[model samples]
Structure formats: structure tokens, C-alpha cells
Target: MSLFAAETRIVRDQAGRSVRVPANPRRVVALAPSVTEIVFALKQESRLVGATQFSDYPPEADRLPKVGSYIRLDLEKITALGPDLCIAVKDGNPVDVVSRLEMLNIPVYAVDPRSLDTVMAAILSIGDLLNAAEAASSMVADMKGRVSRIRQLASGAKERPGVFFQIGVSPIVSVGTPTFLHELIESAGGRNLAAGDTPYPRFSREQVLALAPEILIITSMARGELFQKVKEEWMGWRELPAVRNRRVHILDSDVLDRPGPRMADGLAQLFDIIHPDLAGKY
Candidate 1:
């Protein structure tokens, strides 16, 4: 083994690939915003030498050197950062960039955080990598406790509200069975109106109206005014249960969409929206 190989240990990443991560990765690059958030949550931000664009959570991540967006990584900037390790997301980061980074002898550990369980696993795995396993375990335990409480409270509900969650505008798109949003809605005692084989299915206004959702939820991503417009448009249909009951709500997209420490917070917020009668009870 080379001198560098001797100082590193082999570990399997979430993508089922073996990586030779440094024994102590002092300089690391977070290739996705979620990964950056995870690192920060573990209190390992001091080791982060670089982060991707939109890694703005916790506010402090914005100060880190950016290596382009997660989907389109800037190899040159990443190389300039001289990160001994690069934490990537299997779904968001480009595969070619990972391959190229590996070819250049930079250890790239990729994580696949699809659901709440896997997100917790990712945090623990990253914590092990960064020597923060204790912190990770504590965080996971708290998350689990929150989830159990929500589930227990939801179990007492007589009816599961039909929730129409809009994640996109213009064409009107919503999450399907494979997304974490679906899990959140269901766990919060709400039935996802758009659950299907498709990850994100587009819906026409007529189709949405036909579903007759009891609760309408819209996740806003930087388009605050547009979200208000969407809410107003949905409110015009007086026959809709959500409109009649005033159950329409706008949530910050990052809370539900980003698979990180705040997901528990997102679930709690969703529970409040879905089961308002049982909100403070939890």
C-alpha cells in the first residue's frame, strides 16, 4: 500500500461503493446543500473546506468556499480547495464528477438519503467518518422520539385528511410515492392525493379540483409572491373542502424537501397542519 493508503481506511458509502476515506479528514468538501447541512449539524463544519451553492442553511455555510451547484460541480474550484475528502449525495451530485474526482485520488464518500430512516443513517455514517458518532446518535434518538410521538398521536385520529401538496408551479407538480414528502404527509395522518409510480407528477387544475383534497399544502421555494398567487387561485374554488374550511397552507420548501436534521422539525410542522386538532397535544 502507498503511504497515503496506509493513513486511510476503507468504508462503504450509501451507494454501495468502497471508499478509502482519510483517518481524519481535516479538509472536506460537501458536494450538496443537504450534505453541508448534515456536516454542520454534526458540529464538523470546522473541517469543511468547501461547500456547494445554496448551502445556505445555518447561515454560516454561506461563508464557506463554494464549488458550484450540486448538479453541476466545478471540478477546478473543488481541486483548488484541496479537500482531502468530498461528501456527495448519490441522487443530487453528478456521477461523472465523482468518477473524475476519484481518478484524481480525492476520496469521495457518497450518501443516498431518500427517507427519514435513510437520512438518519446518513447522519450516523457521516458522523463516524468525521469522528462525531456520539452527536449523530443523540440526534437520531431525538428524531426517533419525535417520530414515535407523532405516529402515536396520529393513530388516534378517526379520519386521514386528503392532502394535496403542490411542490411546483406553472405546470403544477406534486410529489408521488417515492418522495419524502409523501411519507411526511402520510405519517402526519394525511393521505397524499398524488401518490403514484411517478416521483413527481404534473397535474392540471381540473384534475386537482376533481381530487377534492380536504387540505391543500403548497411548499414555496423563494417564490413568496407566486405562492400567494397560487393560494389565491386555489381559494377561488369555493366548492373545494380546503377552500371552504380555510385549510390551505404554505410551507417552506426546504423543511420538507431537504433530507437533514430539520426533517423532524418538518414532520412536526406537517403534523400540525394535517391534524390541527391534535397539534399541541403532541
Candidate 2:
């Protein structure tokens, strides 16, 4: 490549759309914790001027002004912050709110990167938008490497377990196909019991009992009763294989539910739960 070409800058999204980014993006705001962590992972923490209420990651992120929840963004407050760039999710943030922000001339990059591969790509995309592509690539590469190691370790494992992922207890919900958590569960060498047309669909207790899941996993909610009370209640159902074998486990919502840079860690956690010797290794 010629020196002129080497020094030239080319910024385009994975979809081939050209993007123009500033040299130094100061006064940044993140709308969600998962998305917030990605911004910090790209090493743009110092430029971040504000974040939403739940955007508490990297420790330093919590120090930023509370922009409000992702679903309900305060346009007045957001406008007052005067951020150079704002990170948001396509599904999490309401369209009307985003549109209003746009009408007010605020630059909002709405991203919805699903799957582990795409998640990493989105991280790199954020870096590119922030002109920190090198830092973002490094973090994403590490996550990719970790995922590869996990798959390698689980390769020679025994027969995978038939797993039931419970998203809720009061009203039974399991990780369904198409959800990244379901993919993570499969990556950890477990077959989802709730497979069919149901994708995060409402399930009945009778349906759960009929499946006879070999392992039952519950994902904890934010600051709620996330432990044994809801999961261990299955102990009464002696007929259930999971209850009889004591294979029921509860996982942190952030670790299992959030599709962030730590999904590899979530997969590692699932692997540990499914395999005895593999525990704590990932």
C-alpha cells in the first residue's frame, strides 16, 4: 500500500455503509449496561460523560450522570448533557424516543448485534465509531479466544444433558431457540428441552413436568429473590429427574441473560454446571 493510502482513513459498517467519526469523541452516553460495558471495553471510558441508571459496569461507569432507563429516556435530560455520541440498542430503546432525539439533532447509533460473533463485531463497530478500533478489536479477540477454548474443552465430554432454562419461576419461562442464551446453553453441551414453536413463550407446569428435564436452570433477576427458594422448590417433585438428581441450579441474570462481552463467561458458567471436572476451569 502507498503511504498516502496507508494514512488514509476508511470508516464503514459491516453492512458497507460509510460512517463519519470524530477524532476524539468526548461526552458520550450509553443507554444500557450491556451496551455500556461494550463502550468501556473499547477503551472510551474517559470520553464517556453520562450513562443510564442501570449502566453500571467498569466501576467508573457508575460515576457518570444517570441518563434514565433505556426504555424511558429523558429527552430533556439527554439534550441537556450535550453528548457528542450516544450508544443505544434497537430493541431496548423506544423508536419514538430515538426519533425525538434525532429530531433534536442528537447523534444516536442504534445497534442490535445478536449472537457471539455479531456481539464482537458490534464491539469493534463501536470502536470504529469512536476511532478506537485497535482497543475494541483486542477486547473482542480475547472473548473469541475464550469461546474457542470452551468449545475445545467440551468436545470430548460425555452425552450432553437435556437442559431446561427457566427465565422465570412464578410464570414458567425457558430459554427458547433464537435467543442467544439458548445458543449459549447449547454451546455448554446441553440440549434445550423447550424446543419447538416456543421462543421465550409462556409455559405451564404440566408442560415442564412432561419434558422431564435432566437439568433445570433458573436465571436470577436484578436484586430479587434469585436463589434456591424458587429453584429448590422442585425438591418436592421427587418424580422429576432433575429434582431427584439434584441438578437444579440458579444463575445470575447478568451472567446468563445479558448478551455482553461476558457471554463467554456465561457459557463457561453453563459448562461448569453441566460438567463436574470442567467446573471453575473456564
On lDDT, the candidate that comes out on top is 1
Best by TM-score: 1
Superposed on all Cα atoms, model 2 deviates from the true structure by an RMSD in Å of 4.4
In model 2, what is the error at residue 257, expressed in angstroms? Answer: 1.9
Alpha carbon deviation, residue 277, candidate 2 (Å): 3.1
lDDT (Cα, 0-100) at 156 in candidate 2: 70
lDDT of 1 by residue, 1-282 (tens): 457534889999999999999988889999998999999999999999999998999899999999999999999999999889999999988999999999999999999999999999999999999999999999999999999899889988988999999998878999999998899888898999999999999999999999999999998565559889999999999999999999999998888899999999999999999888889777
The runs of at least 3 residues in candidate 2 whose Cα sits more than 4 Å from the true structure, single-residue gaps closed, are: 1-20, 280-282
Clashes of each: 0, 0
lDDT of 1 at 249: 96
Q: What is each predicted model's overall lDDT from 0 to 1? A: 0.92, 0.76
